[model samples]
Target: MNKRMVLILKHLLAVDDPVQSEHLAKLIQVTSRTIRSDIKELGEFLSKHGASIEPVRSRGYELKITNDRSFRTLLEQLFLSNEPHDPHSPDYRKLYLIRRLLLADNYVKLEDLADELYISKSTIQNDFKEVKLMLQTYGIAVDKRPNYGVRLSGDEVRMRFCMSEFIMNHSEKKQDEGLTSGSRIIHSEEMTLIRGVILEQIQNYGVMLSDVAFSNLTIHIAIACKRIREGNQVAMLSEDVKNFRDAEEFQAAQHIVGLIEKELQLTFPENEVAYIAMHLSGNKWFSGIEGQQAQDIGPERLLERRIYELGKEMLTEIDHDLNLNISLDSELLIGICLHLKPALNRVKYGMNIRNPMLDHIKTNYPLAFQAGVIGAKLLESKLNVNIPEAEMGYLAIHIGAAMERQHLNTRAKRCIVVCTSGVGSARLLHYKLKSKFGNRLEVAGTTEYYKLPHVPLHNIDFVVSTVPIPEKLSVPVVVVQTLLGGGDMDHIENLLAGERKYIFNYIREDLVFLRQNFRTKEEVISFLGKKMHASMLIRSSEGFIGLVLERENAAPTAYGNLVAIPHPIIPQSRCTVWAICTLKQPIDWAGKPVQFICLLSIDKNGDEPPSIMYKHLIEIVDHPEIVQQLLKCETYEEFARIILKHNLY
Candidate 1:
């Protein structure tokens, strides 16, 4: 169906309860009558796909699936359809306008564009406001004439880069399926031919590229070919071209261009060949040496010493802030050094490469992503160049891999069993633990309650005691019966999994503010900052709020699900803590709707890594049901109960 109908269907599928038409209208920014009409049409469409929209008497609509298999297939087909986006949708209309202008050969009249989209001229003019803002990011501007309408004007290189972003790339398409945009700048056959030629040449020349890099290079070449035929060519400085010509990729670019010249019957300028070589250099992959030691691999030997030094600095900064303990990881060191070499080239040349795994990395590995942000800040400070979110995402992948490696190398949870009855009872509990947890738990022998203080607790993760130990000890004490019940086992399991039994350790009742009326992100942050300052949690409200805003400016913390976990750029608190606020109405947080704000302040001098805390926050961020429950709570008690019930999942 249309884009709005698809959105309605997706929303209905997300929630179990029936949704009111007013809510749907507000969500889609349409009238209630229009939502009803769309729902009727959607119902007819779904009837044939083994699903239907049922109208509840008091409530609005709910999706009902008749056949699970057929409904799943219909869903797959619906999302995969190549139909043009609905023009009535504002987002789609904006995209349509951008693509039209980018591909236009001459200045087309605004009235003509309005007529083409079946929209009023006033509406098209309104859409141009946002379109202009978007184009401005790429250093492009609309040159509007007196009566001739507007045309895209920018540096030729920047124009092509913008074209690559909005025109050449489709989120749904596979990496190998190159240049499947609606612009049709190059025919499918020509794209295939160009890709095959590049693949053959790169393989022949012993140059390695990831699938994403390979596809991107193909798109760039295709764009260059199309632009050259249209009498537009990229101009580079002579010294820059001379430098690129010295690289190994320059030879590969020459061979690849030579073959494509015969196939396409078009001659590329020497500057264009150098441009291709630049892309090749930026996309190069070093392989088959991941397991080598840092000294043996010698990052300085593989790349410029400056890049290796910067990589070390990045790791040191991340370790200092997040305490990830990965600074000494040899594999991670090599990976970062190798990545920085090409990354620096791409950034210097203003090449914007897409990271396909960015969303997945953000959702699944937030701590690592935070570490990536720290690394990005270091790079920006040292190199005096801005690193984009996409580049930070690539850095996160390396840090994430290293984090996982560190986790794997950690030993199993070690604890001693303390029984009051006798040695036999403690032995029974120890064997039970060994049998239930297997290698995940290491039972470090038995101990009497009276002799617990003599037992070396420093080496233990925690102590499983049968009798009550009133006095506090160095290690955590889990009081259990001589015979462990399911509940007791679950408590032990949580400890083993590095999860806190109570989420209140981080989420304090005094820090929670419910049903606040916040109009903007700044106001919400200001409110939380004041509350934190008043509570003596922070030294300066302005400094804390500024840091949080700085991080938001770098990259938004709103991860959808009506949730946002905003935090300072660096650790600013004495201990890791959260100041939470639930808004009475959802406000726009960097374009995402957010009603739940969790202001995270990481411990500046924490000995333990914050990965587990981030893991729990991600669970809350990813679950819409939890956010919904949290938004409904009017009191701190209600909120805490809900969080404790979920127990940080």
Candidate 2:
């Protein structure tokens, strides 16, 4: 099947209900008639593979599986094929163009590229617009000459970084093996040799590198070898080279390079050795250093002191903003200090280290990720360097573990029983709660309804009352029968175990917009910001919108599942609220397709931690079915009902 048919099948497999041909056409940027024809052809292919596309009258097309085993085998064969390239797919073609330009020793003719891809010059020109934009992010540019065509031009270090990202780290190829373009730079056997050399040297030097860091270092060395053989060499200042020579990592780099030179019969310049030493210094981890004093780890006491101070400041900022109450976590402080040492080196040298857990960290630990963002911003300002999202992800893992530790160390929920039936009934309810919840429930005391006013509630989590308390109080009041039933026990248990509030509590009816015709992320954000301002929910729409955009520039807020939760860098409203907009058609958010947009504004003055709110949002991000249901709602009532019905915690 062609790329369009493959996309159609993937979309059909993603959703439960029939998808309209108009929707498919818009998604693929094709005409409705073309979609119909593609669907017909795809149906024929599916039928032979134990699956069929059935058209629903007045609706659209739905995929049905006839044989599960055969369909599974077909899916594996189609997706896992050993095709080196797909010239028919525009995305693949753009990647091919980029790899070709990066590997080119001189300017490559655009006509030659067009002929290679079997496409017209006009199509390739259009493709270059996107490729150029992508390259600009890495500070690389397309150097276009009138008759000579185009080639990649940038700082040698940045070009090598780009190669590591696009050629060596392409998602379609395994990391252990090289892609077609990467093979030109370094073969699998050569990569194995480089890895073995790195392992032996690091082992000999007592240096520890994580699996990701090791892979990145290996790729950098391989790229260095390729560039050196091609008569391209990295340049370093004399002072910097002298400083690296004094570091212990320089000795290890020398040994690794000396062995590689013998094996590959290529000479590495001194600057190349210094570059390898920089990578080693930036990626090393202090293994078995947990709980150890910072003074004992490094030779430079002043640098360790500075890192510790920065860690303390970062934790303080996180605690003040989110009210996580983890600033006093010594173990967390030690971990952050240790991590910052290597992280600062990587950031200072503009080295890009990949975090394999970035997506999982964002989805599973959003609150911690937000804290990571806060910490990264602080570090950026203090250190005068930009911290990439991958580094922020690593930071979040430490913070998330600290949050988990805080949770584990928490005391049981404390409550006071208020009964109108008298002391006897209050005592009965208190004992029943104690019997049911065990040590999880701590009953401070019981009191009569009239005397409850004098009962101290400062330390209580909630009020367990037999009679409904009409008057509002500081703590939540859960009313149950004199003889507590199973439902009442479950309610109390949820309050004790789950810190989450109802998802709709933060959602307002006036703020929910359904079936919006927003064509871009900017349009959607601007509309929501204006709505919030008009409703007097925020002080200034422009200021709020600018902050949201700044956060987006730092990292895109689109977290898959057709959802994009755009929020300010910090809390911007007096109270927390969500301005939700569901698009009639999906918009490209950064790179992900987003149909559901939740504009979040945290309460600036509230004492409650935002983690509970993030938990509810994570529930929506994790469930595609819930997002689809929300996207289909056309009215506020329908949206509210769906949110309340599927409230996970």
User: Each model's TM-score?
Assistant: 0.87, 0.79
Q: Give one digit per residue, the lDDT tens place, for model 2 in 1-649.
A: 8888887887788667787886677566678899999999999989998999999897788999999999999887666542333447777778778888888888989999998888999999999999999999888999999999999988888899889987776443533232243446788799899999999888877776878778889989999999999998888789879989988889889999999999999999899999999888886555334344543443244246788789989999988777888888877887788789888888877877777678778777878888899999999999888999999999999999999987878899999988888667777888888888898889999888898889888999999988899999999998999898887877887799655555556888889999999899999999999999988979999999999998888778888667889998888787888899998888899977888999999887755458778878888876655776787898988887887787564
What's the lDDT for all of these models? 0.83, 0.83
Clashing pairs in 1: none
In the range 412-512, model 1's lDDT, one tens digit per residue, is 99999989898788888999999999998999889887888788888899999988899898878898987899989988998888876563668777899
Point out the worst 10-residue segment of candidate 1 by lDDT.
Answer: 171-180
